[model samples]
Target chain A: MDAIDCDVHCAPDSYEALFPHLSEYWRQYITEAGIRVNGLAHAYPRGVGATAPSTYEALADRVLDRRGVRFVILNCLTGFETHRNAYFGAAVASAINDWVREEFLARDEGLRASLVVSTISPEDAVAEIERVGEDRRFVQVLLPVRSDLPWGHKNNHAVFAAARERGLQVALHAWGRAGKAPTPSGFTTTYLEDYVGNQSIAQGQVLSFVSEGVFERFPDLRVVLIECGFAWLPPLLWRFDKDWKGVWREVPWLGRRPSEYVREHFRATTAPAHLPRDPVLLDQLLEMLDGPGMLTYASDYPHEHGDGLAGLLDRLGEEQRRSVMWSTAAELYGLAGNPAASSRA
Target chain B: MSHVEVRSGGAPVTKRGVELVDCDVHAQATEPMLAQYLSAPARRLLERYGRRTPRVTEWYPRARNAGMRVDAWPGKPGHIWGSDPELMRAQLLDEFGIDYAVLEVLSGQDCYDHPDFAAEWNHAINQWQLEEWLSFDPRLRGTIAVPHEYPALAVAEIERRAGDERFVAVLLPASAAEQLGSPKYWPIYEAAAAYGRPVAFHTGGYVDHRGPGYPSYYLEYHVGNGIVMQSQLASMVAGGMFEAVPGLRVVLTECGVAWAAALQWSLDAAWELMRDDHPRLERRPSEYIREHVWFTTQPIEEPDDPKQLVWAIEQAGIGERLLFATDYPHWDFDSPKQALPRVMDASLRRAILCENALELYGLPRERAVP
Candidate 1:
């Protein structure tokens, strides 16, 4: 099967790896400040096998060749999205984008990358998107799923506008902003809670996007949720559609059912399948979720979410499997019929 | 007017031969009613603020009739919707042949910044429910409303009401200052468990209600009910609170049901990958959830295709744990007849509508159709 791996992660080998990409001032600022990117330690921990490839050869060896994926979208999260200092965050984000381009995209024919942006400042995010979004190899703009404010807030609209203007889809990958509490209540006491809470945060973002009129404003925008599970979508959308009927007047800009907008606008990576162990129930869930239309295949390489994918694949029909594994993401990222695009770039 | 004649429009709900137990029926508390029970200092605060304290601002304005059904208002000019117990009995208990209606009084007192005031106000609300609503009807039951932020006071309130059979559970807001499973809240759980009353976390609180921040619209806030519930559930499972208080049982009310199955899967899968993160957990995360938690089906997920709902319930693997609720008087009330899918199995329907709640709350199984 020719699969499009929608979410494969990469990171700088070390802080020094980003030095050449960063401006001289930022390089000095980081070194003098003794700053470090903790690799989103709260989420990825230290030794639970969530190590991302620091180079293109490693990613290709691990995901492309081993997994036989036709294409892989490289998501390089430098942990700068949650950085407290806005200016420093912006500089680090720019460096991460450059590093992703020069190291990953420039090396492999099967590689495409997401432009890293500082979520703290929409103006800087837009500037970063405009700078690298024009690169055809850069197919989407990457934002962390966890943010100080939801991406749908009007304040962040410019970042979406910039991505859409440059014909880039937005990918909200899981694990972000360690400084911020993972749950609505407050901080979690364990990593298990913080990690599982990512899906809940993803749910919040989806509601934010639909209810805050982000979809209405950017009709053509497509947002893919990477590393976040998709099985939860059916129920969330069901509630969303029902509540919108009762409260549509509050968000008057919406012209259709919230589920309809979500179905049209959103796609989710299938790494953390979050599927029932029962085959019958898994089939039922896929049917409820319109799996063929909404799910995109991803290895979420180096993050060891269990072997639920085999069960998901077994439950899917041949055509539906093809759609989930390849076509849905191809259409979502405009990679269909463009086999040579990555090579040419 | 006869009880059956005044039912809000829908097919007859009590046709099935099972008892109907509404797990979530709101009994709105008015300022004057609650102030009557408070101490002088708290009473003065209540009188001065009039239930609209700076801490309890309505950031997410509900869409219709202040989040209540227009017809739910009592005929009296100044009476609030769902305030008059006779009207509630006529509309909900008698109308639908409900054997037991567990009253959830969201007094807005829990959000008070002043701990002393919050504790006093919540205590007053509990007293108000006992005298004004629960005592008014034989079918009604009470929840011990608590100032959850101040766990010591919450524990005290639970202990004070421990002997009351009319009060079936302890009520805590789903959104709180910290996740309900934290050590700070263990004392409240201890008190509730000591008395054999399950703690019910209903949706609504002063917390921002989203991990990110306040959402732009009430629709988002409405959708956030499930999100916050999932967070709390994950917190409880991971914080080892279930291990800390083995007798603790939780009922998540008015937070949609379908998300539970998905959260279970996510928790189990993540626990597999990250088991070492929390060495305190003796079993898989889902095990604790299945053993300890119950869910209420109010504002039930009504998918476009009813069969999809059947699939969701099956996926949730919690038919025995499902508790049926109407969220009566709220604008998005789920009618007993139409809330669930018609395609559901007869046995499952029995469990959801009556048997499950009976097992959870230890209510009498006799059909009390007035």
Candidate 2:
């Protein structure tokens, strides 16, 4: 069976690496301003235990090659979120996309990437999508999980519209130096606080998308929530389903149950697979989430300490394993059958 | 302590020697009482502006009784369910056989945006609890409603109220401008810790910045309350508030139980990989939650399987952490006898209904049935 690794981060070492891809104006501005690379605070410091193995060769060999991944979607985590300035964000995103394309995807036949877009301006995001989205290797449009507004709000419709127009999935990955705390609440004192709080943001974004009628607005758009643990999803959806019954009129555009739309329009990548001590509870949780069809395999490559694909496969039933390991992602990313399929064969 | 007339239909205590303590019974004061406590400027502004509280929408629909039990209405044209002390006692404490009921007042003024108003309203409400409610009923324990945005003022209130053991906890709105874990709110935590008072975070009053955004209806707002609580819990755990104030205990009043289980698992998972991000955390995040946090059993998550509920409670370590709450006079009040599974252990039932809460609040146990 061909396996599709849905989430794998390919971070650039420095701005110098993307200097060729960046326009002269940005290069000069960055140099003159003495702006450090990525200009964003990393929750995990480099050379620390949490830092993923950095080299592209190491990622390919350790994750894709070792795991027998037929295809892998590269999600580049750079300081693109530092670009509150529209021009700067767009330039950083463009350079990162170009850097990933040339330095990684081109070299690996099995590699694919999410077209990174600076969402400071939907117009810029759409334009960037229009520019780089046509590339067949780019399977999705990557936006950081921390956005100014819920991604479902109409303000974000342009990015989703552009992605759907290009036959691309929109993936929300964890990165971006959030202007406020990752949660609705203001800043926390520590990085751990922000990290655990990411789940709330992911859950809120999903609720925002469903409640705001994002699916009804664009039926073709699919959202993949990456790095957010999936155990909390069942409860959130259950609550949304219960609440939507009474408030459906508020969002009259939503024609079905919130959970129904969730099952239809959303895909989740398994990285930090939060396994409860009781394995039975984990099984029941997945059953509640309708996991066979919703979960996708992801290593969060080089990020030290995620539930590896092998560990997850061991826990799931055969049917669930198949879906989580490859099929669900392949079907979602629209890679059911492609040239890469032959590599596994 | 003052004496009160005992009424029937008191919330029952199923286990013998377990005197029932309702974790979340509300007490409310009329508008005139609130006006008296306000500063001259606030009172003048209140009269002129007609009590401005930030709301996302003009209308918030509630079922008959305004999302209170259909029968809980005081029958007075002007009164909501918990506003009438007599009605609250008869409907919640007497009928349910509750030995004690902690009061959580929801006046819509708790989350007042202006620092002066929020502080004054909280002070007034806490005062109202003292004069009108606690003085009227010894069975009733009061909470100091602290204005979370102004930590200095909030800490001062906690300091003032610390002498009164009747005031068992400090109540902060579930929804706040800053999450409970943010260092900005730590002064309140510090005060509570110094005084050995648990911080009770009750749902509502946090409409300004809801986790998902403002809702169209009250049902969404009501169910979404737990989501807000979850975020606050994460903030507290991740923000290292527990580390900063080691003696502090957080009681999640209106938030449901199951999410804590999920958070425990998820936090532990995240910590395993990202422990370096928070070097101050001496132990796993879940360990901090287990030791420092207590969740109320109102809006208890009703999973399809009866066993799943127990499984979740046990999985979250809430068997020890869960506090039985009726959310009395509200729409979804859980009758203690029926709220939990029939198969629950007698010890566990007693712990949730009476013992755990008594221990956390440092209330002396009344081992004999009253």
Candidate 3:
């Protein structure tokens, strides 16, 4: 079976690595500002500990070749989402996309990319998508999960429309630059609170998409929640379904239960996949989610977790494993006919 | 073809008969009536500036129900459902056969910018509960609402009310200016612990105090409540609130228990990575959660299959930690009998519906005279 790593991350080796990707204007500005580096530190405090020895080349060698991965979608978190200046946000996102292309995708045909965009200006974001949409190597349009408005709000529809036009899935990764506070309550004091709170932001955005009828508006548009824990998905959908039954009149366009929209239009990555205290319960949680069909594999590289796919794969049945490992992502990025769908089996 | 069960008022009873103790039952004060209980200065502040809580944007305008169940509004022209204790009794306590229901008023006391005024306003609301709601029915109990900004006064209120068995716990807004974990809030936790009362977090406060920022819509606001609780849980544990107040217990109301399982995992991992930061923590953070934390089940999360509720309960190890609540007069009230999964185990159902809440509130086990 061909496995797909939907959320493998790589950071710029240095800020200067993006110098070539930036315009002369941004280059001069960044140089003058001495904005020396890009890492998770810009989003939150840095401490992923245990950096994996494997870079993209080694991932191609070890995971793609050895672990039977046909495709690896590279996600770069850095400061792309956190940059406050709209133009700088666009520049940083563009630079990261370009850096990922030259550093990872150019070397490995199996690798794919996300056109990271700044949502500070939807027009700029749409323009960024248009610039990068033609590159078949880029499988999705990426934005930070936290934004000024919920993902379903009309403010974000322009981004979705642009992504839909290109046949690109929209990926909302957890660490976006903070729009206000990381949560509705206010800013968190600790990184631990911030990290755990990211899942809550993801849940709100998912609710927005379902309640606002974003999927109904853009039927072909798909959303993949990256690094947001999937355990919340089953319960969240269930809660939304019940709430919608009582409040559907508020949003008449919603044709069915919130979970129905979720099952069809949305997909999630299993990076920091929670292992319920009862391992059997984890299997059952997936069952409530209609099995692993809605889930795609993600290794969330450089983040420390003892078990990734091995932990989940051991509990899942064969069909569920096949779906989670490759086929689901294969269809998601429209990679079915491409070499990304090739199999060892 | 389709098999589903629907009941008008609530669910039909099953054989393992045990009455429930609802941990979260809201009672709103009728406007001018609560003003009567307030001190003169606080009353003037209320009349002049209204609530001074920071306002953030909320995009989804509340439905005509005002984000409440349509049927919840009291039939009378001016009054809302939660405003009248007699109506609340007929609808919630009597309908569900709840033996004991904790009365937490949505006073908007936490919204006040001035600590003294907030303290007085919350005190008046608590007094209004005793005079208005709790006096109406013995089955109804009250929680001392304290202005979190004024810790000494908050503790004094807890100490003042601790004498009355009718007041079983102290209520604080989940999203506060400072996390409930901070040293500033510890005095309040200390008082609750001293009184052998749990500090309960009922959702909703100043829109600005809510973490992240204002949610664009009410639906986003609703879902985001769980996020606020998760942050508080993490902050309280990692920031060493439990370690500081050894006897304190925390009840997370409205925030569903199912989310706790995922949170427990995150907490455990973070503690392992940053154990040194919390030198006082004796065991893993999840252990503190299971031991000290209790979750009320309203807006109770329902998976597609009935068994997933049991799975979530099992995952959180909160069969005993879960307390049943209706969140009376609110939009998403869970009918005690019908709300839980149909296939739930008799023992587990009994535990969630009654025994757990009794143990948490230090209430007696005897059934109410029906």
Best candidate, TM-score: 1
* Winner on lDDT (1 vs 3): 1
lDDT (CA) per prediction: 0.83, 0.75, 0.76
Interface RMSD per candidate = 1.3, 3.1, 2.5
| Chain B TM-score, candidates in order | 0.92, 0.90, 0.90
- Give candidate 2's root-mean-square deviation (CA, Å): 4.9
The DockQ scores of all candidates, in the order shown, are 0.72, 0.37, 0.33
lDDT score at residue B281, model 2, on the 0-100 scale: 81
Q: What's the TM-score, to 2 decimals, of chain B in model 1?
A: 0.92
> Native contacts retained by model 2, as a fraction?
0.41
Question: Which of the two, 1 or 2, has more lDDT?
Answer: 1
Pairs of residues clashing in candidate 1: none
CAPRI accuracy category, model 2: acceptable
True contacts kept of 1: 0.84
lDDT of 1 by residue, A1-345 (tens): 788888888988677999987788887888898877676676776745667889877876777785447788888887544468888888888888888888888887678888888878899899888888888888888888887788889999999999888889888988877677767767989877777777888999999898888988998998999988888898999999989889889889999998988899999888888788888888778778766588898888788788888888988789999999988888877785445753311
After best superposition, candidate 1 residue B149: deviation in angstroms? 1.9
- lDDT at B188, model 1: 90
